[model samples]
Target: MQIQSGFLVFLVFYTLITLVLLHAVYRTSQLIVDEEFHLRQGEHFCRGRFHVWDPKITTFPGLYLISASLLGPFKACSVYALRLTSAIASIVNAYFIFIIRRTVVGKQEDARVLLESISLAILPPLYFFSHLYYTDVLSVTMVLMMIYFSLKEKHNYGALLAFFAIMMRQTNIVWVGYILGWRALDLAMKLCLPNENHQYRLRDLLTTVQTLLGSRFMFVRVIKLIFSSYYGYILNILAFMAFLYWNGSIVVGDKSAHVAAIHLPQIFYFTLFFATFSGSELLTLLPRVLRLVRNRWYITAFGMALFAWIVQQNTIVHPYLLADNRHYTFYVWNRFFGRWWFARYLPVPIYYGIVVSLAFLLFAQHNGRPPLIVSSLVWIVATVASVALQQLIEVRYFILPFLVLRLVQPNVRPSRKLVAFEVAFNLTVNVVTFYIFFTKEFYWSDYREPQRLIW
Candidate 1:
């Protein structure tokens, strides 16, 4: 009864918010370049440019096709129409969030799961993007659906949704691959180990490989199992390659400018965001953390200062404040480290060391490693590593993985104080960010002229 009531309330609340966002975003005069470009591509597709490719475009045709299908019927190219799609996608995403919560926390804790769904629905990062017409919401919605089906033990449906997600955003291949990889790992472990109680070790691996190879039939069976489990991933990879080939380049947009490169600080940035988002949950563990850091407060302080200094030196400048080099990104990269290669790249090793150490500690704290828990950790680490390999550093890139990780997290049964804090913090941040989106201007600085926008 409580679950039903909470769901009803959330439905009404989310619907009202979506309607307001759709109305406001459609009427706004200001346009972000990313959305504008996507809109144009949609228009072009509607006008029979299906076979044509644009080198300037940085993504697949999934979103363009979606928008064209919606707008072409009415002969509308309005920003509102694009955002209407996003609004609808977001609602569907909320439903998936609810289902995911129920799956992770079980039906017995209906109220808790409902609250978790609300937290997901109100997540500021996703909320901000849902107001725009970009593929972010649509893609994330598809990804979430994939996760839902996977958790329900429906791999066929998950694979289908994953294919669609890849179409929505090519980068989704990494996410889909992560899921499939975990499944493959789980299957391999099951096949190689004689019993569920077997502990995996170097010697055990050697013995298993030798035993399997000694029997040709068993080796053949192992090969068959491997292929059968991962056929979907193989198909997706082939599709991705075909799309890239048809697009006439392995990557879209400015490849030289945005080629794959290791940026170790990405893990740090995303981990910090996740920690902040659930700061209340983490506060419970603060005593232990503090105890670990006791007598090392000065070292911790120095490390934070060093991190701040490094950020100051390598911040990517935002276009709106380019003229004034006082902005955080500008101050860090331009004023401090732009001219010195040594200073610019000096933090890479330190970040790697810290992130790796923390990740191992996190895994160690889990005690018994169930397949589900181990797979989840692997997925999180792989997702973070994927972003770390990217040339660009965008907060949006981290949003889906963060949400997914949170969704799969164990039920904490947070105290009333913690729940209240989370609710208040989410509400405050959402309201402030929403107001800023409508009232303020930020700029995309990659172009020669730079474009004015709000995000």
Candidate 2:
């Protein structure tokens, strides 16, 4: 019965997504924004032109290669067909979400798990690109699959998916490292100190590390365990390093525009983004947040000051961010943060509060085990590595991090009201974004094509 209910829910959501995808294709038949390059490259692959490469494209050719395989039977890669790849990937992502939740929390067929999975699958930022030929949907799917496999102790499959994820986006190597670390910690806990209580505190982690390092015999055992279990992950990292050595950079092309930098404000932007998108969940945890603020006022004050300094020093308004009015980020920057010189500092408190709230939620105990210890540490590192060096403020960059955090945090069970609100909120955003994209077309002064708003 549970399986049937889950399948039914998935089917209903899938039908809705397919309708939206069809409508999007019918309305915007021609390529828009990044689809122009994506579809063109996909067609190149379809025509057996393997040597051709697009200089403007930064990520690897995974999307195009996958699309070409799917379109092989048709012998022609239509725009709709190419777009369908992401839509299909979105559905696969939803399944991965369900399985990951089941693997982590052990409720295989809970209705709450079903709702959460579908809700995340249709997250506005990610759902919007499902009908477009973009890398975000497929990239996220690969990463989620990697996580799901890793959690299931299938390191070989996880490593293979991690490689695919990196191919989809070079930045996903951070996530690959995160999974490797998580598995390493899991192995260390089980093999070295199985009798110890798994409290997952900083001290516990330190003790575990000290014990492993203090004894050469235990250290050798852990090394053998890692090599026996996680050799695939090590190979993946080594290959990535070799690629970096050969290419001299992570990006495949367009190195000039994709330069890495110290953009500390990106993390703040992500916290704000998380608070906004997960508002219902945060609201439910409001009392906990208030208590945290009341108890740690000084830390909160220092955090706010630190965030203000970062915003003042490291806030980057990329050329694309200012020039691309089509994306929602432009209006957000222009009307909210960039409205006045003082406006940017206004959200410092909010960012600090959200960070504290997230820390509490992620670190809080559940059933005698920390919600996340090594995973949370790895997530912070991976998130910082993924976003702090990025010179752009693209919301797509936050999708994987948000999804990973939401998935691993065992306490993120939305109430019925919050679940309803989350679904309604995401659907509303999707409707509004799609309506504007289809109906409110204007022309860019430089280009002859009609410009439409997206994201």
What are the candidates' C-alpha RMSDs?
5.2, 1.8
Candidate 2, position 368, lDDT: 51
lDDT of 1 by residue, 1-455 (tens): 76878798888899898789778755654355566677677667766677766666777788878777877778776667767778888888889998898887779878767766777787777877777778889999989998888888787788888898988887888778777776765565567676856444444555666767788887788768867766776688778878778865545765555565566556666665666566555665555555545656776666666666656544453343344431233445565456575574565444533443344334433334322544555676667556777645466777877777667755445665676677678879888866665676544465443343333
Taking the candidates one at a time, how many backbone clashes does each contain?
2, 0
Q: How accurate is candidate 2 locally (lDDT)?
A: 0.82
Collision pairs in model 1 = 312-332, 313-332
lDDT of 2 by residue, 278-319 (tens): 866788778888997889899778878888998988888899
Candidate 1 residue 366 C-alpha distance from true site, Å: 6.8
The stretch of ten residues in a row with the least summed lDDT in candidate 2 is 363-372
- The candidate that wins on TM-score is 2
Q: Compute each candidate's TM-score over C-alphas.
A: 0.79, 0.95
